[model samples]
Target: MLTEVNLAFNNLQGSIPSSIGHCQNLLAMSLSHNNLSGPIPPQAFELPSLSIFLDLKSNYLTGGLPLTVEKLKNLGAFRVSRNRLSGLLPNNLGSCVRLEALFLEGNLFEGPIPSSLSSLRGLVALDVSDNNLSGEVPEFLVSFGALKYLNLSFNDFEGVIPSEGVFKNKSATFVEGNNNLCGGIPELHLSRCNSKTSSDTSLKLKVAIIVVILGVTLVFSCLLILWFRKKKEQPTTTCAENSILQLSYQSILRATDGFSIQNLLGSGSFGSVYKGILEESGAIIAVKVLNLLNRGASRSFLAECEALRNIRHRNLVKVLTAISGVDYRGNDFKALVYEFMEYGSLEEWLHQSINRNESGIMRNLSFFQRVNVAIDVAYALEYLHHHCETTIIHCDLKPSNILLDQEMVGHISDFGLAKILSSDRLNYSTNQSSSIGLRGTIGYAPPEYAMGSELSTKGDVYSYGILLLEIFTGKRPTDNMFKEGLSIHNFVEAALPEQVIEITDPILLQERARQGTFTEFTLNDKHLQHLNSIFEIGLTCSAESPTERMDMSDVVSKLCSIRVKLLHPTRVYRERQALYIAQSAGIQ
Candidate 1:
């Protein structure tokens, strides 16, 4: 029946018994401010029911933090501060994902801060102050989504303090008494770093310059000889790129295992995509085989080729070329070949229980990786809506349609429903009515599209916004969780700045621990403000009234500003984004 053991402020003696692990009903155990000594019993940590907290602070506990600390998976707060716990912090403390406030301050802990601490995504307050922890104040501390209070004071932490994330506000994070600490935000008043880049690089550059000068003279003479010997070539224009060569039907069959299921990557209403390698170039390619039997599939295939050929951006999927001919059966086979993305699609990363690369090792997308992907998608849309020769409306914009390259960069794909707004086609005639039924995928399709409203760039913006929310929250716009007048839009809207954490994709939190970037928690004002701006952007972009949604230009500029703030937090970019959104939404 026991829920909490509050033996604090008592004069208890002797070490805690390992037998306490048998208390299956215990929720919180507080032996803090007691006269306990000796190493913490491993069995106490072994208890599965200890969830609220395990406070043994203000005691004389000895030995390193137990490796058994990971056993406390449900532990909320771990306070062993002001103890004599010596030795390196256990790397697996990160596995205790539920830990909110961890207080190891005033301990004898030594050695570099464990790189494994980056895995604690839900950490709110962490205090290793007055310890022997060394190394640069971790840059990853700025990356944790929920971190708030950090006390690293009186430690041996050295190197330049980063000026991003929670580090931007020196007042919130306590790094004082670490005399070696230098170069943080201007407000911190620490001395600037003497060497931003390594001095060795400068010396190496000088040596390279002298070698280049000598090598250039010899190369120039050789080049002159070769130029005379080589045949003259016609000059080529750099204006537009030519598409990749089109392969024959037989060659496509050879590249793939004769249309075998093993080579198939995915399938859709239009056709199935197969992963194949070009025999000549040895290059991996995705072969999209148009299912001619499906209505409008042929039209969709042509639309995709036309859309891809007319425009090219690094964030848009590249078109190798199209192959129009009969297959082995001679039953009319039409396929579009393109670059094969090793990472597949963002949908897999978001929804899959485990995402493995080509190597087969399971991988998780970090929070910032998703952010970058969002930016990549936005940049692609901005180019499509404005920078392209003809304004292209990517009628279908969903996570499955958003492919990721090896580097986790997002590329907008599937332009089957693409509507190019040419000058002459500005005023749509009766022909566009045919597209009313093919605006986009159901859940991702904007309300306007469902209502037979003319599809516009704003529709793509809506899809992208839904995609953005799905990326961060790990919930589909059409998740069964949505019913009785609730959608991803208002689900996010009701949460706003405070409870957004509750609705956020738990994957983001767990993936945070794996991120090399220091886990900067969102407890501080700076992080909350940043998330507020992001969620607001999602809300605004998906507004039911298409006209009220933000344009691609504004989306690009503002998303870029958010990124700039993350990279260089010297300015209040979150506040600026918030103000811009307020003005856009007409909030007084």
Candidate 2:
């Protein structure tokens, strides 16, 4: 009856069992980030009901992808990246027409990309980078209307790069480390393609000779002048300084009406946030002005700027620009401008008793909405920890730092306490000087921080676990009831599979009541089970031992499974029926 199997981020080994194919009801399977080795069992691809995804990335799976992949026609995502798989991609993979994401990067995939991929017009993200993929960059990619992010970098692709579709958008496409690539839009800065077979050789030679001589002369002249200049003479800028908009203090002052209280959005330990509208573009923005008088305010400003400079993700708040200059009174002023989120922070939506109408009825996040927000935040953390060039630890993760967009999608904000772990030293030891200070807010911060434990991604995971628990229970970690030995973790942990209903948010129960799913005397067993599973995930993530906590990736996978179960209870019932029939036949 199992529909989803997620065994990621574990030490599980051995090849994926071919017997797994017997589970015809399996809708999603994630065996990623594990030690599983050997070729992927061809039977794994034969599941027709796998509509969610089949994630086998970051394993030791080898050999070519099976042609039976065509069987997963309903699959939405297929990720087998960061493995040792080899050989040509299966041409029949085009049969998975519903796939919106296909990640095959960081493998031994060789040979030209199959032409059949052109049929995947619904692809939103396609990454085939860091492989042995060669031949001309496919022109059919230019026709994919839905493709938003494409990474063909670190591959053996050559020939003129396509200048249309995802290719035209520099930020949307990545084609770096392909030395032989040529002739894209001017923004790509690749060498122009030259005709190998010219009808008039002498004329072509003359033009080429003239061009080379002029190019050399110009380069040499520029190099000579640059050599004479001292390094200190040149002004240097960080990625943050160059990428953001240049806004003067006066413009920001005017935008926020001289930092008026009426425009105030919120305040943090380091600064105050205010709502503003740019005069020129009439665009709304959220401005964070630093309290320079505070001891670490300057450092916090630089930390935020550094953290946001190069990273871009839909679930993370976007920084419009940063300002660091003197005010009208000649005082040092520093601030950051971000795209304004219409719905404000998750804190308000969760705790604030705002009346939606004259009835004075309070509005609260529905159960489904809360799950979606948790998934969004998990995705952001996953990107920060695993996808970024340098691992980023949010350090401080709480409801107040989570903002909601107009669509009600959660975006993680406030990078003032963020920590960047260098790629070489991803984990720090307690003795490391960098581990000396305690970071992050109380109640949200892990217990190890107080003991001078090194800051790590686990710290962020612990914070996220607390946040997830808060979202469902409608109780803050610092709640008045959680005094003495009782904390939010143990508070929720004490109420497991049975008492989950008692501790769950009343608003959620009320929502179910409105839907006729719950009443004063009765509660749906399935609903209670789902809540139990969610609370278990929260408990596991916030476990006292850092080693015992689940990774953000695993947390995401488990939560996604819970969401799928909630949305497709009928499918679960059908699966149970099928299992019963098979078992009855075997008994006969």
Off by over 4 Å in 2: 1-244, 352-361, 415-438, 512-523, 569-588
lDDT per model vs. reference? 0.73, 0.77
Residue lDDT tens for model 1, 1-588: 777788876657789898887787888988976668899988888877877878887666899877888888888788897667889988988878787777787677888887788877777667787677888777788897566567787677888788787777664577765657888888876767776374675688888999989799898899887655431221111112344464777777888878789998888776888888879878888888878898777665555555566665667887777866555454666787778887888877887654665677566777668778888899789878865666777777898888998768799887343333332333433245235335788778899766667767898899888888888888888889899999999999999877867887776655334555546444356555766778889889999888889987667656655665665533231223322332333221
Best by lDDT: 2
Candidate 1's error at 584, in angstroms? 40
C-alpha TM-score for every candidate: 0.53, 0.64
Candidate 1: stretches off by over 4 Å = 1-241, 352-362, 415-437, 511-523, 569-588
Lowest lDDT block of 10, candidate 2: 579-588
